[model samples]
Target: AYTVRESTVFYVRVPAPHARFATDLLCEVVGQPRLDPADVEIERGVILGELDGALDTPDDVVFMNLVEALFPGHPIGRETLGDPQSLVAMAAADIAGFHDRWYRPQNLVFAAAGALDHDEIAKTIDAHFDGRASGVRPERIAPGEALGSDKSAQRPIEQAYLALGWRGLTATDPDKVALAVLNHAFGDGPSSRLHEEIRERRGLAYEVSSSAASNLDAGTQTVYCATAPEHLDKVRRIIDEQIEAIVTDGIDDEELAVAQGYLTGSMLMALEDSSSRMSRLGSAVLTHGRAIPIFESLESIAKVTTDDVKRVAERIFGQQHVESIVSPDGDEFDDDDED
Candidate 1:
C-alpha cells in the first residue's frame, strides 16, 4: 500500500478548503511501480526531451549545472530529469535496479492528514502491506560536498542569474526550526533582508530570495539573485556584505522578535487549510518518521535568538559554495573583475 499527499495552499478567495486531506487506498502497488519495458523506454525518451527543453532555457541550464556541481555523485545532485545522454543510453536493467534499490516499502512511509482517520489508514495498511513485508531496507545514499565558486559559463544576456548555495542541515536535524526562522529573516519573503536590500532600497534587479532544499538525509539552503551583467559585481558584494553583517553583528532583539512573529504566523496560517495540513503531516511522517506537531515546531522557532541565527550564518556561509552565471555562452567576461 502507498499514500499520496496533495499539499496545496487554498487562498481565502478560492472555494477550496484551507486544506484538504485525502488518503488513497492502494493494495496491489506496494513496491516498485510496474511498467512494461516498452513504456519505460517511451517515458525515458519523454524525460530526455524535457531535459533538452530545459537546456534551451539559460536559467534552467545554470540551475541544473549548479546542482550537478553541488551534489557531485549524490542522487540529490542527480538531474531531476535524468541526464539525457545517460538516460537515452540506459538499458532496461538500469531503471529496474534504481527502482529496486529505492522503492522498498520499508524505505517508504504511508501517511495522510487533514480529514483522514488514523484507524482507517492503519487498517488499510495492515490489509495491504503489513503481511507482505519486502524484508529489505535499502540504505539511503549520502549527498556530496557543496560546489566551489567557479562560474561554468558566460552568456551574453543583459542580466545574469546567480545561484549561490551553502551546505545546510538535514531534514531530521533538530536545528531545522531555528534555520527556518533564520531563513525567513534573511530571504524568505518581501520582508527579508535580501529583498529589502536588493530590491527596495538599492533598486537592483527585482528578485532575491533564499530557500532550504531539505531531504530525508540532507538539505541545502541557497540565495539567488538576478541583476544586469553590469551590476553583477555590486550584487555579489551586497550578498557577501550581508552575510558578513549577519555573522558579526547578529540581529537585534526587535529583528528577532519580528522574524519569530512572521515565521510563526506564517506557519499557523499554512496549517489552517486542509491541503496544507495534510502536506505538512505527510512530509513529516515520510521524512522524519513522525509528524511534528505544528504548535511545538512554532514554539521552537520562537526560542531562536539572534545568536543562533549568527551561528548558523557563520557555519553555512563559511563553506565553499556554488555560483552559476547565465549569460551568452560565447561571452568573454572577467569573473574576477569584482572590486
Candidate 2:
C-alpha cells in the first residue's frame, strides 16, 4: 500500500524469508515504475470512486473542511485525492513527469526491519540503487499565515461532526515533544480532558479526540467530536473551557506523568511490529535526517515539564482557530440554544 501526506510512503509486508525479494520489488516500483497509459486510466476511475466515498464520509468531510479553512489557497488545503476535474484531466504523462521530478536517489531512504543481516541488505540496495545521479532535493514553499475561519455544511447524517483546527509546530520544532504531551492530556484518550469532560461526564459526545499532524515545514492541531445536534453548543463550550484551563493553569504533575507514561508505553508497543519499526526507521530518517533512538525519544517526553506543556498550549491554543461542522442544520449552534 502507498500513502501520501507531507511525504509519500509505499510499503509491503512479507515473510522474513522473502525479505530480499521484497527489497528488490520495492526498489523496482519506486525507482522505475512504468506509468502505462491504460493503467493510469483505470486508476483514475478508482481514485474518483475513492473521492466519492470520502465525500460521503462525514468525518472526512468535516476534517477536510477544517484543513481547507486553515490553509486556504495552498496545496496543503487541497484534497489528497484529486478532485473530479483534476482526476479527469490528469494523464499518464502528468504522473510520469511527477515521478521523475520527485523520486530521486538523494530524496529517498530505504529501511527494513526483521531477522535480516544489515550488510546483506545494504549490499542488495547498493546493487540495485547505486550509480544513479544524485538529484537535487526540491525546495519547499511554506504555506502563508493562516487566519481563523468557520465553515458549515448540512448532511443527512443523524449526528453532528465538528472539527477545530489551529496552526501547529513543524516536525523538527523544539517544542514538538511538549505539544505531544499536551495532546495526550488534552484529548488523546479516555483519560484526556476532552473525552472525560465531553463524553464520560457530560455524555454530550460519543467520540471526541484531538491530534497533532506535524510535517516537514508546517503542521496542524485539531480537535474533533461527534455529537447530537442539540448538544453541539455544549460540546463546543466544553472544548473551549478545557483549552482555556490548560493554557492558563497548565497540566498538573500527575497529568504530566500519566501523559508521559502513555506516550512511552504506546511507542514501545507499536515498535513490536516489524512494519511499525520499519516505518519508524524510514520516517525518522526522512523527517529528521537521521534515525533517532527510541531511548532519545522517550527521554524527550520525560523531560517535558508542566511549564513546557503550558507554554506550548499557550502558543497553539491561544491562537485563533478554524472551525468546520457538518450537521442536520447547516449552521452553528448558538450559545442561547444551550439550556
Candidate 3:
C-alpha cells in the first residue's frame, strides 16, 4: 500500500523467501511507474468516488474542516485526497511529472525487517537502483500561525459530529513523547479522561477519542466525538472542562504510569510483526534521519514525569484552537439547542 501525506510512502509486504522479488518490484514501481493515460483515468474516477464518499461521512467532514481552519491556506491543511476539481483536471502527464520531480534516489530510503541477510538485500537493491542521478530534495515552507476559528457544516444526520484541533508538536520536538502520554491519559481510550467523563460518567456520546499526528514540520492534536444532537452542547462543554483541568492540575502519578505502560506495551506488541517493524524503520529514517532504536524510545516514555506532561500540555493546549462541527442544525448548532 502507498500513503500520501506531507511525504509519500510505497511499501509491500512479502514472504522472506520473496524478498528479492519484492525489492525489485518496489524499486521498479517507484522508479519507472507507467502512468498510463487509461490507468490514470480509471484511478481518477475511483478517487472522485472517494471524494464523494468522504463528503457523506460526517467524521471526515468535521476533521477536514478542522484542519483547514487550523492551517488556513497551507498545503498541510489541504485534504489529502485533494478536491474534486483538482483531481478532475489532473492528467497522466501531471502524475508522471510529479513522479520525476520527487521520486529521486537521494529522497528515498530502503528499509526491511524479518529474517533476511542484510548484505544480500543491499546487493539486490543496489543492482536494481544502482546509479540513478540524484535530484534536489524539495524545500518545505513551514505553515504560518494557526487560526483560531470555529467552523461548522450542516448535515441531515441525527448525531452531531464535533472536532477540536490544535497546532501540535512536530515530529522532532522533545515534548512529542510527553504529548503522546498526555493523549493516552487525556482522550485516547476508554480509560482516558474524555471517554470516562463524557461517555462512561455522563453518557453523552458513544464515540469519543483524541489523536496526535506529528509530521516532519507540522502536527495536530485533535478531539472528536459523535453524539445525539441534543447532547452536543454538553459534550462540547465537557471536552473544554477536561482540557482545562488537564492543563491546570495535570495528571497524577497513577495516571502517568498507566499512560506510560499503555504506550510502551503497545509499541512492543506492534514491533513484533515484521511489517510493523519495517514501517517503523522506514518512517524513522524518512522523518527523523535515523532509525531510533526501540529501546531508546521506550526509555524516553519511561522517564516522562508529570511535570513534563504539564509543561507540554501548556505549550500545546494553551494555544488557540480551531473547532469544527457537523450537525443537522447548521449555524444554529451552537445555539441553545441542547435539551
Candidate 4:
C-alpha cells in the first residue's frame, strides 16, 4: 500500500484464458460501484475505523501534519483515508458525484500485463467500454500553493515522530533526477547516510528514512523518523548535519556510483514483473499524461553527477522547510513554529 500509486486503484488479475472476464468485471465495477444505501452505511463505518486508526498512528499523524503544513488547503493535504467527520456526513450522492467527475475514459489509463492477443483485447475492451466511458476533463476548482511552515501537536503516544519537509521539484523538472540521486545517498535505504548515522551508529531512532515524492503540480522532499521523546533534537541535528554535508562537500565518486546503481537496480527489479510494469506505465500516464520510457529513466539516473546532486541539494534544502513533530506529552515544539 505504501507504493507510488496516487489513488486507491481497482485491479483484478486472472489467467490469460480468463482475461476477458477480468476486463468485463473491471468495466462493471467502474461503471457501478454498488453504492447501495445499506452497503454505504456499512462501508462508512469501515472507513471511519480506518481514519481513527490513522489518527492513532503517530507516524501517520505526523506525516499528514507535515503535508498539511507544506501545502495548506491543498487536496494533497487531505488524508486519502476519509476523515471521521467527512465520513459521517458522506452519502451515496457524494460517491456518485466523485464517479461523475473523474471516471471518464479521457481520465483513465487501462494497462495489463502477461500474454494476450492485442486485437482480441481491443475487441473485448470495445465491447465493454466503448461509448459507455464518457465525460470531459474536469477543471480545477482550486489551485495549490506550496507554502511551508513548522507545526507540531501532542498525542498520547510513547515515542516522538517527526517529519522534515521541503518544497520539491515536479516530476517533469530536469532537477528531479539529481534529487532522486541525492535522496538515495541521503536516506532512501539502510545504506543511506541517515540510516547509517542515525539508526546504526547512534541508535537514536527505530525508523529513519527519507523520500522524494513527486506530485502533479509540486513535490515533497521529506525525512521521517520516530524516536524517544528526549532524543528528537539529537536526531534532527544529525539529519541536518548530513544535509549540510551533501550541500557543502558533495558525495564522492564512489558514493555517486553506488547511489546510481541502487536506483537503477531498484527500478529494474520493480519492472521485472508484468504487473509492476503495467502499474508503472499506467501510473506514469495518469500522473504526467504520458509514459516515460524505462530506458530514458535509466539514462537520466545514470547521467547524474556529483555537481548535479550538489546543485539539487542546495536548491531543495535551501527552500522553506517545514518541520512537524508529534510527541506524546511534550511541549518543546509548541512555540518553535516558523517558516
CA-lDDT, candidates in order: 0.69, 0.87, 0.88, 0.81
- Model 4 residue runs over 4 Å out of place are 1-8, 141-148, 330-339
lDDT of 1 by residue, 198-244 (tens): 99999997888888777766677788887877788898899898888
Candidate 4 at 54: error in angstroms? Answer: 0.6
Candidate 2 has an lDDT of 0.87
Which residue runs does candidate 1 get wrong by more than 4 Å? 1-34, 91-102, 141-149, 154-157, 333-339
**Candidate 4 on 1-339: residue-level lDDT in tens?**
222324557787678899888888887787667778899999888778887888777788888878878878777666787567788998898888888778777766777778877677778767766876577876644335557567787777789888999888876788988988898889988888999999999999989999998866778899999999889889989999998998898788988999999989989998778788878877888777888899998999989999999999999998778888888766565633321
What number of backbone clashes does candidate 3 have, counting pairs of residues 3 or more apart or in separate chains? 0
In candidate 4, the residue pairs with backbone N, CA or C atoms under 3 Å apart (3 or more residues apart, or in different chains) clash, namely none
Give one digit per residue, the lDDT tens place, for model 3 in 147-206.
846778787778889999999989899999999999999999889999999999988899
Q: So what's the TM-score on candidate 2? A: 0.95
| Model 4's TM-score against the true structure | 0.92
- The TM-score values for the models, in the order shown, are 0.82, 0.95, 0.96, 0.92
Model 4 lDDT-worst window of ten = 1-10
Q: How much is 87 displaced in model 1, in angstroms?
A: 1.8
Q: Please write out the lDDT profile of model 2 over residues 1-339, one tens digit for every residue.
A: 666567778887888788889888888899899899999999999989998999888898888788888888788777788689889999899989888888888888888898988888888878877898778898888988966367777766789988999999999999999999999999999899999999998889889999999888789999999999889988999999999999999999999999999999999999889989999999899899899999999999899999999999999988889898888754454321100
Name the 10 consecutive residues with the lowest summed lDDT in model 1: 3-12
Backbone clash count, each prediction separately: 11, 0, 0, 0
